[model samples]
Target: MDTKTFGQTRLLKACAACSVVAALLGCAAPAAQYYPDEEQAIEDEVGAALPPGSAIVEFTTNSAAVAAFQQRVGDKLCEPDAQHIAARVRRREIPSEVQQNFRGLANFLSLGALAQIEKLPKTKIAHYPANQPIAFAATAYITDGTCGPLFLQFTPQAAKRYSLSMDFNGQSCRLGIREMDESTQTRPVKHSRWRCAEGFLGIGKPTLIGPDEIN
Candidate 1:
């Protein structure tokens, strides 16, 4: 390659790098209000532990990609504006207002050591209603994008510890739910495949829904 050609190649690479950095540092997404303040978080956390309440679910997503866990609001199945257990962006990537608003059960994530994480340094946790069967719509996203949301459901027992996980290997992803036994043992919970009466992959967004939800 001639010197001029080599210089042009370098310029192109530089522009691409700039675009990525701009997206990373400046393009953080909007987040929902999980906990309003410390006092409310405490009350909610305590209430969740009692019978006919929520169960503690520790989340450990071991993947370079970031994913979201959205619980159905009341009976609004597969609604776009569901409650976010974890926003699609990592906690490290969350904007300042979210940092101040969430605590206790909602204060489970605090990782910002890397501009882009290889994997979260440790597990992040969450609390969800356990009085009845619950389900979440999950979607994974990477530097490029990801396959669309799929459904995950389990009947969480009160006072029991639960841990959920997701793994994304570039081409595909996997989600798992387990009923944790006294914080020591984990047993997998199997259910019939999820049924969503409707589906939509946000166009031009980070998710591109496949023909089916399993990805």
Candidate 2:
């Protein structure tokens, strides 16, 4: 299929998944905060128990690639009861034409900023269970109330560090997860994006085949 077609298809799938997730996760109201840093910390104290020797996985970003770039989105864990960020801006107060014309000004003067959103971070680290199904979700809230959400499930390898990032560029938003090769410096370390085929919560139709991603 062509690039546009592929993008549209992916976006459709993501939106479908996003709706199901929104219903299950109570996404009707967006959280004032961005990342679930405190939530994750609480999880460590009382969530799930990881197998011995579980490795680490870090998100290159806890929030959207651009602050408020994804206008409104749910939490990243892909689990129920996760928080959502509602990049609150009185867009009604400012004309759309003006917003398009003065992007930085609009961002700086948002009600969310008054809550000290400037203190938000772009990265998050977590302890992941190895060789087990782990679910994750990301939604890119585009302008004009359009949002794309993708839910994926994969497993991490023991003793390996994984890095994951999500980006949205118009047609499609991609969630790229890669294992950071821990090879000695004698050989250059490499990190290649892996694929997650499983649908965490009735999301994708499973067009993928392979457990290779678990490693």
Best by TM-score: 1
Q: Tell me the lDDT of model 2 at 188.
A: 18
Residue 10 local lDDT, model 1: 9
- In model 1, what are the clashing residue pairs, if there are any? none
Instruction: Please report, in order, the local distance difference test score of every candidate based on alpha carbons.
Output: 0.47, 0.40
**TM-score per candidate:** 0.52, 0.43
- How many residue pairs clash (N, CA or C atoms closer than 3 angstroms) in each of the candidate models, in the order given? 0, 0
Worst 10 residues of 2 by lDDT: 1-10
Residue-by-residue lDDT tens digits, candidate 1, 1-215:
11000000001223344344435433354532222222121112333345356677665454435666677556445444457565333323223443334322122232332333423332555566766766666666654455445566566776777766655544666666666885478675543235343334534423322223322
Q: Which stretches of candidate 2 lie over 4 Å from their true place?
A: 1-52, 61-109, 114-117, 183-215
Q: Please, what are the lDDT tens digits per residue for candidate 2 over residues 1-215?
A: 11110112132334443344334433333432443443321112213554476866655433332322121123233233444432221111112333245444434445333224333344444575677655554554433233334444555678766655555544465555665765722211222222334577867653433223222
**Which whole-number lDDT from 0 to 100 does residue 27 have in model 2?**
36
